[model samples]
Target: MTTRRRAAPDATRRSEESRRAILAAAFDLVGQVGYARLSIEGIAARAGVGKQTIYRWWPSKGAVLFDAFLMLSEGETGRPALPDTGDLEADLKAVLRSTVAELNDPRYDEPMRALNTEILHDPALAAAYAERLDGPLKEAKKERLRSAQRAGELRADLDLDVAVEMVWGPLLNRWLQRSGPLTPHYADSIVETALNGLRRPTRRRRDQH
Candidate 1:
């Protein structure tokens, strides 16, 4: 009697092939036709797989697009993320710098831009966008904030929810609005203003110069 691996080399290769084809087709069709016209059927046809194969893995085009965008970014917004070296500002600057680099990648920008446009016009798609895109980024930002709080680098009284937004809100506003290209210096400014706040400090009698 002998035991054979259920996932044989051929089976594994086939699975990889299907996955690659699905992703490639999803990206290509979305890039070619735009999200409004993209269809599972078109994707399946382009991928050379049955529609059932796509459905078996992802429930909707939004899911596929979300994953494809993430793949394109190589998890820039979430996975393989922020380093905690006890310097809150340094860690955030590093993260934001990576973000700038990711947004500049050609593979990442178009599909994400398409998804963003769709999210604005459709409620269901908007919800999926939140779940897949915004939600993960929010969590990652929050975790970094918590580390900063723990280190006493950021104000302890800082509201975690608001603090997270404070750290990211301005940068995202610019990115989403296409207001301007973000620089590391811009991210650093956001961090400073968020942590130190907008008010100018009052003079202390002991510190007169």
Candidate 2:
């Protein structure tokens, strides 16, 4: 009988390092050159890997950029959860303000704009984006809403899916369309308005005769 040996731990670490390098290169290059000028050759050259290596892992430049954006969003801690400090309004405002800051940042602005452009045109990439990035983040948001619901902070019957969109959609649209400044004040207004609509309506008292 013959026994097969597992791959060495060093090999796995090297693979992980290479993957991170490729992702980082794609992220930085897109910011520098914009998405239209970004290519696998450039990414590979920047990453210190062969073009074939990138092709082996990703189907297209759009796909590479998508993963790169995902890695950047995840940071060193994998996926992030929405803040839940037991005060839904304050927590949501904090999250939205942070988002506004990122969107306004020069390092993130170009890369995110490029990712949004790709998602608009590529159906396959859009689907993957929804599945891998949007879906998880949306669910995390819904969970926070669910907590608010449990705490009676929101209407028990409130539709969480719509609620999430209501809070986030305006910020995204404003940024993408360049319609307005993405400031902390704008983020706070969004949270306040959305929460007002989502909360249980107050009953009016009868007028005195």
Candidate 3:
């Protein structure tokens, strides 16, 4: 009897390769041509796959773009965690500065703006964004805050969800609305202002007043 090997693994590998190619094509095309002009046909042509391939995996262009961005983020740094260097204020400043840099980067700026716009109108994409991208990042931020709480750097009673929002919301709003420049100075100011409200007051400081 001749032994026959299963081709399942090979097929799976090919499928995964195709998926990655599609995602990369979508990302590259969006960065090259703004989201307004991105199309399934363009992505399929660039990826060297049929239009049905993209549709089989993703429902719409927004879903493809979201996944493409998610893939880029994961490839860059596998679900980022906030730095907890024991000094909550300094750590937050560093993270915020990094965030400001990313927001200002041309490669990321347009794609991110497009994704945010999609989220507003596409409920399904919004849910997936929350679950896959935003949710994990928020939880990581909250964990850093919890560490600060445990170290007595932050108020024990501080609501972490609210605190996370307070630290990040303004910057997000500014970026989305184009109200102000996302500069390192703005990032530092945000950290300083948020820390003032969130930090546990010291007894010596209180005695001075």
Candidate 4:
């Protein structure tokens, strides 16, 4: 029953070139001067667009930076889908390993760190970031977990919402905290630990009994 809002056909849309320029400008400026010093004026100047043009598409500097972050993430993450091999452990590990690779990319590291700082400081911006950037990825993970639940591979009573967070939380923590290398070894360990906690307890065989 939920209705999704669709853009009006007559809506004034920025040209693809302009949009690309703006995102590129944001990325370059953030890398040069850092996110705290980034502004709509600077981006406009770099992109050769009027301030109104940037404002028309995004409400604030934070929003613009968030969009730029998403643009870069799309390029690095490439469609944000998890593997569904029917083996939940394997699928989870595979997806998390890919995530570790993205986090380790030098191009993304500084820009994402800047964006994360902004989100952490602003509650409203953080909510918007989660909805726009993280929501789709989390929903995909939830869907895959739900499939496993239906197959009796996961506990029926498990809260898939928390389960999704568990799958991602540690990886993000390590990436953000700089506590350890975000390698496949670390990713596999996180998956095994989380899945072991979530998996349904196997019933004993008749011969064992």
Of candidates 4 and 1, the better by TM-score: 4
- The candidate, 1 or 3, that scores higher on lDDT is 3
Residue pairs clashing in model 2 are none
Model 3 local distance difference test score: 0.88
The TM-score between candidate 2 and the true structure equals: 0.87
lDDT of 2: 0.88
> Candidates 1 and 2: which is better by TM-score?
2
Better of 2 and 4 by TM-score: 2
TM-scores of all predicted structures: 0.72, 0.87, 0.87, 0.77
For model 1, residues 82-105, the per-residue Cα lDDT tens digits are 678888877777787777776666
RMSD of each: 5.9, 4.6, 5.5, 5.6
Q: Model 4: per-residue lDDT, tens digit, 1-209?
A: 01224655444243656777998898888877877788999999999999998887887777777878777667765556667888999998888898798789866676788888888889997897788688878888888999999988999998888998898998888889999888999999999989776555566444466
Worst 10 residues of 4 by lDDT: 1-10
Instruction: Quantify all predictions' global Cα lDDT against the true fold.
Output: 0.75, 0.88, 0.88, 0.82
Report the candidate with higher lDDT, 1 versus 2. Answer: 2
Off by over 4 Å in 3: 1-7, 76-79, 198-209
Of the pair 1 and 4, which is ahead by lDDT? 4
- List candidate 4 segments past 4 Å from native: 1-14, 50-52, 55-59, 70-80, 198-209
